[model samples]
Target: MKSKFLAMLLAVSAISFSSCTKEDEEPPPPVEEPKVYQLPGLYIGTYTVTQLPNLAPLRYVLAIEPDGTITTEGLGSDGKTYYQQGTWTLTGTTVKATYKTINRTSNEVTQSATLTFNEKEGTLTEGTWKDLVNSDGYIDGKFGKFTRVKDNP
Candidate 1:
């Protein structure tokens, strides 16, 4: 009976020492890293500018700098040389920019547009724009599109 008691005590002690709760048995799960979203580097493509009635859509190159500035130059379909200067911001997958269209010769802001880009493809996408200046052809519409042509600005 003493041997039996010793064996039972040993078994109970072994079981008690060996058993562990889930938290104590395994190292705390490795800390999970937080999720982060990265902004794109550079985008180069044509953006449409509203032209006078009967004129074709103007062709312009959109240039985004590392400092969130929009600087561009192009020949308007109406036969005017122009450039743009403005700043841009990003929210989620949307990019918003407010720029002024300046006539190269006159050096005046002829029009202004607030463009909102919402394509997440990281390659090509269409965006809508509303000209801040209420001119004849500067109405709100889906007149903006750009393709990611390069990286690192």
Candidate 2:
């Protein structure tokens, strides 16, 4: 009887100690990263820089391909003809583009813009631009408001 009690106690202790609750044994699913949703349609239109108190504004005819490649032909801040090739991506409602200018008279100019989508007018506006590549001769100021021309075709 004493041996039977000892064996039953050992078995009970083993079963109680070996088993764990599902919550403690299993971990929750890995935390997922935030999802970035791009714009629904093709982004191809005219892009213009609307503010420049010191120099002339830029007007770019932008064409964004399906593979995210971007090409533009427009006027530059230096009052010269400008052509750029770059890439763009959209995160939520904000769109960001990075491109390089082909013409470099004094220094190489790379354009990077973060723009918000205007749903009412079917346009992208209120852009924040940066010249990350050019520094020696490029002017220091905000990129100002960028407006896309209507009837983009």
Candidate 3:
């Protein structure tokens, strides 16, 4: 009778342990990684009018939005803040921007620029700034180079 009672106790303990394991334990939850923010299509940076000595290098924020909108902005120490906005298209390493620029005095000028992106130098090379409607060039065909500016990643 004692041996029979011991065997019954052992079976009961085994059943209890197995049921406790299945009911008490659960799977681990999934881990989520952090998301990173990124800039738009165009390379934004600072541009210097190499031909003009009196003007200082200004910050230029150029971006082509998802809806095919183009934006070109720059600030000068000479009090000539400019913003050029319109449509942009990219082909290979080259970008063509046909936009209108407005200065601090609200003088509007129409222009077009064909610029090639130089990845090695992190700059925009072979930039040709021209006035489409007027012979008197506002940028004066003076666009030469636009070096990339580094910012927080």
lDDT of each: 0.59, 0.63, 0.65
Best by TM-score: 2
lDDT tens per residue, model 2, 1-153: 999999999999998877865756868889997543233333433344434554554455666555777776766666777888898887767878889888776668887877786644445666566667876644334333434443322
Q: Regarding TM-score, does 1 or 3 come out ahead?
A: 1
Over 1-153, each residue of candidate 1 has an lDDT whose tens digit, in order, gives: 999999999999998877865656767789987533233345555455443444455555667776887766656565766777888777756667778875454444433434444344544355655667544444544444555556546
Which segments of model 1 are wrong by more than 4 Å? 1-42, 48-54, 102-107, 110-120, 134-141
When summed lDDT is taken over every stretch of 10 residues in candidate 3, the lowest stretch is: 34-43
> Pairs clashing in candidate 1?
none
Candidate scoring better on TM-score of 1 and 2: 2
Per-model TM-score versus the true fold: 0.52, 0.54, 0.51
By lDDT, the better pick of 1 and 3 is: 3
lDDT of 1: 0.59
Please name the candidate that would achieve the greatest lDDT relative to the true structure. Answer: 3
lDDT tens digits by residue: candidate 3, 47-141: 55545767765666676565667778866546666887888676777868898865534445787878886545656667766667543444544
lDDT of 3: 0.65
